[model samples]
Target: MPYYMFQWKYKNEAVKALVQTPQDRAAELRKVVQAFGGRLHEFFFAFGDYDGVSIVEFPNNERCAACATTLTGAGANDLFRTTVLLTGDEAKAALAMANATNPDYAPPTGYTHHS
Candidate 1:
């Protein structure tokens, strides 16, 4: 299973709803992830570009995308946006593969490599 970090920012409407009626959102989101054959490792509210973030593990990218699409499709678009995250190891492997390929390319106009 691959892990993902899901981040979101609440809309004014959602903030108003929460202020009027606080709810156990973690439990709610856990159920959604479980339904998609995924596990919700953690969920937290934060202060920054995003209002909340969640760490989850799914079988594959398709399953992860399905979860995002379903949530966003079901009225979340007005409430928040989601992002998929990758692990450091995965990123390192990708970099290694890119280096192994030794791709040949020239820089844009007015730029030159000095090596």
Candidate 2:
């Protein structure tokens, strides 16, 4: 299973709804993730650009995409924007591959220094 981080900012309506009906959103979130054969590791509310974040593990990207699509399609799209995150190990592997390739490019001869 691959891990993912989902970050979101709540819309005004969502905030209002939460105020009106305070609930254990983590439980609801867990159910959603479980329905897709995934596990919700952590869910948290924060003070920042994003209203909340969730760490989850799913079978693959397609399952993750399905979860996001289902949430967004079912009116959540109006209430939040979601971002997918990658792990440090995944990034490191990508960097290693890039370094192995060592792509190089030449600047155009007409290019001039601005600084």
Candidate 3:
């Protein structure tokens, strides 16, 4: 499974609706995720550009994209974005792979490689 970080901001209508009737949105999303053979690891509210964030694992990129697209198109969100997440071990492996095969290219002009 591939992990993804989903962040979203609520539209005014959605905010109003939640204020009037609060509920655990993660529980709602878990149904959708499970339907797609996915798992919702963590879900919580935040206080920044996005109102909430969730860490989820889906079978693949296609399913993740479809889920994100459907959610964003639901009209309940003002902002929505999904970011692919990599584990520490995965990051280390990527670094080693890159170190083994880095592209050699010349800089455009007056450039020096910075350590």
- Winner by TM-score: 3
Error of 1 at 70 (Å): 1.8
- In order, the Cα lDDT scores of the candidates are 0.82, 0.81, 0.91
* Local lDDT at 61 for model 1: 84
Candidate 2 residue-wise lDDT, 1-115, digit = tens: 8888887776778789899999898998898889999999999998987788889999988988888777766664344544566689988998899989887866898998898
TM-score of each: 0.80, 0.77, 0.90
Better of 2 and 3 by lDDT: 3
Compose the digit string of candidate 1's lDDT tens values, residues 1-115. Answer: 8888887777788878888999998998898899899999999999988788899999988888888787776664354555567689998998898899878866798986699
What is the TM-score (0 to 1) of candidate 2? 0.77
Q: List per-candidate RMSD values in Å.
A: 2.9, 3.2, 2.0
Provide the lowest-lDDT 10-residue window in model 1: 75-84
Where is model 2 poorest over a 10-residue stretch in terms of lDDT? 76-85
Which regions in candidate 1 have their CA more than 4 angstroms from the true location?
76-79, 109-115
Report backbone clashes per prediction. 0, 0, 0
